[model samples]
Target chain A: MTTFQPLDIVRTSATVTTAPPAGRDVEVAKLIDVSKCIGCKACQSACLEWNDLREPVGTNLGVYDNPHDLTPNTWTLMRFTEWENPQSGNLEWLIRKDGCMHCEDPGCLKACPAPGAIVQYANCIVDFQHDACIGCGYCEKGCPFNIPRVSRIDNKAYKCSLCSDRLAIGQQPACAKACPTHAIMFGTKTEMLAQAEKNIGVLKTRGYSKAGLYNPPGVSGTHVMYVLHHADQPQLYAGLADNPSISPLVEAWKGIGKYAGMAVIGATALIGAFHYLVRGPNKVSAHDEDEAKRLAEAPK
Target chain B: MNDKAPSGAPVRVPRYSGSARINHWIMAIAFVILLLSGLSLFHPALFFLSGIFGGGAMVRWLHPWAGVVFALGFLMLFIRFLPANLPELTDFKWLAKIRYVVSGRDEFLPEVGKYNAGQKLVFWSQAALVPIMVVSGFALWTPGLDFLQSTFGIKATMDHRRLAAVVHAAAAVTTIVIWIVHVYAAIWVRGTLSAMIRGSVTGGWGWRHHRRWLKREVADGHVKSG
Candidate 1:
């Protein structure tokens, strides 16, 4: 039996660096192994606890998945996929942690209307602050993983931040640390890539032909990497996009629309006010003023 | 269509009841709140508006309830207004030439009864969206009704929220635009707000703005004096 390091048992304050200089490069992360995960959901719970995210309590959807999917409250999730293997004549269950991949060209970052709602941290973890986020679906539309889920209460956008606070404090993410089998690991992107390649080679020797790493090329490479056992492609995962690309239309109109709408209404109002002020007495017809005075004096 | 007082006495017809006004304003306020909150949450970048509900979590918690409140308010209006909003054969007669009302050409507008073609369009379209949003909103809120909801907890998803959102927002946009037109018409012809606010308009307002309706009300004995 493996021990849960349980960060709280020997609790200490996070010794985090306040800031990284402009020229300092972001250290990216990678964590996953297809064969080892038993789909145990300790990672999900730990993530919620570490981040001060609310505990999810609700009816389960097919698996032990509760609260069903990611929401404003729950940012990280484990996706379960089942497939029939062509080579092995047996079925297999594939589990991948479904959260913000913290892509190099982050879609949520691109689509955010606020300046700092979804942001990159030292570990290339995507972070969110409730105060900054608008629940616009532009991030939902732009993401290849379809990671940004809108909260029902205020319609604000929400998704994984890769447990940014942990990285800041010089600690492994709650998800990776709680993962019993080391199925989820965290490290520099380069080291993680090296380990992923080696793991695939070992699986190849073990005669798993379809085994491969997955990080869609067009997504600017997700910080969270995956190794999969497949009878098919990576798109088999839940929430995977058919085609992923940034919407030029959104890019063009996003900021411009708000200002444009304000300007139109403001200009119209100003002109109307101008007309009223400049042409007030003239605009009021002689018949109208006489009738108004008569009604005012005649009325009780 | 004459602006002259009726031969017998005068004209006084109630336009909107107190219940109708109450329902209308409630729906309007709720719709505006929902729209602002929804816009703030639509994109991570737009997250700045979360402050409207105090912050992000508050927005997340309150958005659904706001939707529920807005829908219920609209339901009250629908229950009260549906009968009047029905498409009468005569309604279509006025539809083709509604532009005349806006063009300052009083003579060209059709012999509109209580509501002109423009008003009729706003009323019916707004009424239609209430039920659509209520049904869609429920399906969206209750998690287990659809299998996708069962699998992904997508019940409260942006997909669901946005569907109702589009309808909710579209209805609001149409309503507000119509409101602008309505205000312009009232001022253009005179005394429109007086009837709604004070429950009476000058004889000139009723005759010039709703001539056909005024004539019928007087003939049917629904009006006597203002």
Candidate 2:
């Protein structure tokens, strides 16, 4: 995958200090309405075909989800969750298309050590430059969603680029384009948010009183929004974290913890050098040699 | 090798065996490689070190594997030296006069054994931290251990892996600092490096630094005339 330098990146991994020049690039988003989705795997197939990825076909383990969970080759997946609504006495099939959330505050970008390995564009799409990835899997550690995958074959990190290639040419993501029920909506962030609100209102009239958009604020809001019927209970949808934030451990590790480590290493070396200079090498003196000889030659 | 003994010179006691010296060097070399590669992946400023390992991809591939080798070598070293490096009551006396040791004023210090308090501390610290490196390294190697999810029912979640990465990096930084002290101490105590390099130390060097050890070696009739 080659970048055309088309992205006007606002933030980059491991180079957080330098801010990119301010630009007027409108943010884009993909909204998936969980209430409308029928558990069709068309989006997953479209993702595979468009990305040109050959994720190995595998047998199912008691579920409709094939190839089960996400992998390096599988960028987008249709996650199926069978939820039983206790109050309504109905079995609701909650199908969510799981992929990179493309957060405004991308934890993957924050945790990545390799420069240019992960980048966030002005349009709010988080992308991984595989060529620059060391495959150390820091991005995996950084991601709250656990999105990035490290491949053993190339030893490079990978994740959903939000179809950055297609978007560069004014085309929507393959998954959104292939949606049969128009469950997945793609447009400018503003337009998508408006559309999601309108859809949620219609869902409210249809008895989904709690229907709302899920643009999690913990990540400062993701470009990928979810219009959920049971929005208050996101965990009902296959352990989709109700309050996903970058792990505090990751924040410390990538934040002050990084500098503290550097300081400790630096201080140790400097102290060693200073000690060597101030207090010279301790050499064995002639008295010590004489003492050793006397001891060795002593009568037993 | 630098300090060749003259004819009828002072007897030299065996400090390390040839095989032990080889093991030490292997561990040392592997440690350096791991430090460079790990640090390269640690921060952007040192990422250039990835060049030494061929590239970022290669470093990523090699670091944890190299860690395995280092860990194995360290395990051998730990076992071999454990009896000697075990803390004794006299080690406290040695620790009490740490100032004298650092300032090269050993007259105030206690008669030392095969290893000093400092060496024992290094041994124990590494013993404690090496396991952390291995366990955390395994957790971070996501693609390599995806099988665990199915086989052992270990869900390698992002938060779990994230915690592991932090612990791994933190432990590595600590190990590197400890190693710096170990290397510096070996050099500052003039004849020490040669023990790992040549597998022996001059009787005089041993008597001055580790008098009790030299006495024991001589009493055991293992001393060789230089």
Candidate 3:
């Protein structure tokens, strides 16, 4: 449990004014080399043990993945996709680790309405504060990658924090530390990028022509990246978003729409007040009372 | 059966029934609750308003329930008032001379029915916007969405939830503006609040603002002359 200082936070949800930290922290990243992975479940177990989470035992649905989908307790998952290489006519099993990407611009942070519910650290780690969460699930809608999962029991959202706790204590993430194949590498972003480049070079020499890095620029590049053999089609790795970005609808709702709507509401109230003061009340006149009396008397 | 006042006193004409007044008030109160709770979650500046509702979580829990109550109350008002709120040729004329209507120049305006054109506009616009609020609101509701998915095998996708959020917020803003207009109109027109509060208005009030409606009440013996 590392104590976080105000200077550690780069951004906070629903905050109007946030001063930039005095100095920048060295940005860190987790690089997953897909070609070197062996579909082992050590990372998942390590995450559970390190986080002290106990996910309920679930029945197998005839798949290699356990607990079918990401849940509140299960922050990390191994998604298996069996694809056939058309050129080589070989069936290949692509296993990808699925969790929060911790983007430079996190949609979850943008859409959160509760003040201080979500925060982005200087190291590019996005984390949620359960105490301030209102359980509205707006973060779920804002996420382009559909990472955050709102727990039914607590009504608070849960997702991977990229092991910010461990990182603060100068240790790698639990999943990265537990990877037996050294597939998940953790270090400064520059070192990881260089390492990914070296791995991609080795992969190309082994005849994976389309191998490349999966740090999508749509969300200004994620701290968590992947080196995919078929980077051109990330969907091959179990429905990974090809071009992930915050939805335009979310942007509109949280961006211009919010400010404009508030302005219009304020203007309407002010206009009503001004009109009342200027025009005064529409009172009934004496002549109208006389007419009403005469009409009542003359009526059959 | 008429409890008449002394001679030379003013007459009173019935406008809304007791039940109708009660229904209207319930709807009004529910709308107010929704507005405060909704505003608390809408912007950071208004977040302090949540303190009245206990906190942010409380407001979140109360908002949708208040929405349901509002929808039910509005539904009754819609059915009861629909006959009187139907658009007429004079409604267009009244709208055309809206400037005069606002300036307290009733002579330039046509004789109106139980509801004026502005009131009718509030009625119909709410009738259209409330359903949008309810449907989109359900999509954004966490428990509601879960129940829908688990019970009916209807899963609301993230895209659906996103669209619902935008649509709900837009409709809420429009409704809030319209509500402001409605409340201000009541305050601007003297003797109008009494009609909803006591279920009757003075004959002079009807004659000044709604002569046609007054004449019908007199002919039908709904007015008690003193």
Q: Give the candidate number with the greatest TM-score.
A: 3
Local distance difference test, each candidate: 0.60, 0.85, 0.90
lDDT of 2 by residue, B1-226 (tens): 2354433576778889988988888988889899999888787788889899898888877887888899999999999998998778999989998889889987888999998899899999999999999878888875435655667777766667778888998998999999999999898998888798788888889889999999998888778543
Q: How many clashes in candidate 3?
A: 0
- Cα displacement (angstroms), candidate 1, residue B160, comes to 4.6
Per-residue lDDT for A1-300 in model 2, tens only? 454354487887876366675684799999999888988888889998998898886986998777788889898888888888999999988888889999999999989888888888878899898778877778887888878888778777777888999998889999999999999989999999999989999999999999888999999999999999999999888778898999999989988888899999999999999998998888887667767777776665
| Residue A120 lDDT (model 2) | 83
What ranges in model 2 sit over 4 Å off? A1-7, A16-19, B1-8, B142-156
TM-scores of all candidate predictions against the true structure: 0.68, 0.94, 0.96
Q: At residue A178, what lDDT does model 3 achieve?
A: 99
Q: After superposition, how far is residue A259 of candidate 1 from its true place, in Å?
A: 8.5
- Measured against the native two-chain assembly using Cα atoms, what DockQ does each of the candidate structures obtain, in the order listed? 0.12, 0.55, 0.52
- Rank the candidate models, highest lDDT first: 3, 2, 1
Best by DockQ: 2
Q: Which candidate number has the best lDDT?
A: 3
- Model 3 agreement with the true structure over A120-184: per-residue lDDT tens digits: 98888989988999889999988988899988888889999899888888889999999999999
For model 1, the stretches where C-alpha displacement exceeds 4 angstroms are A1-24, A36-84, A90-95, A105-115, A131-160, A174-183, A235-300, B1-13, B31-70, B82-93, B135-172
Q: Give the lDDT of residue A23 in candidate 3.
A: 64
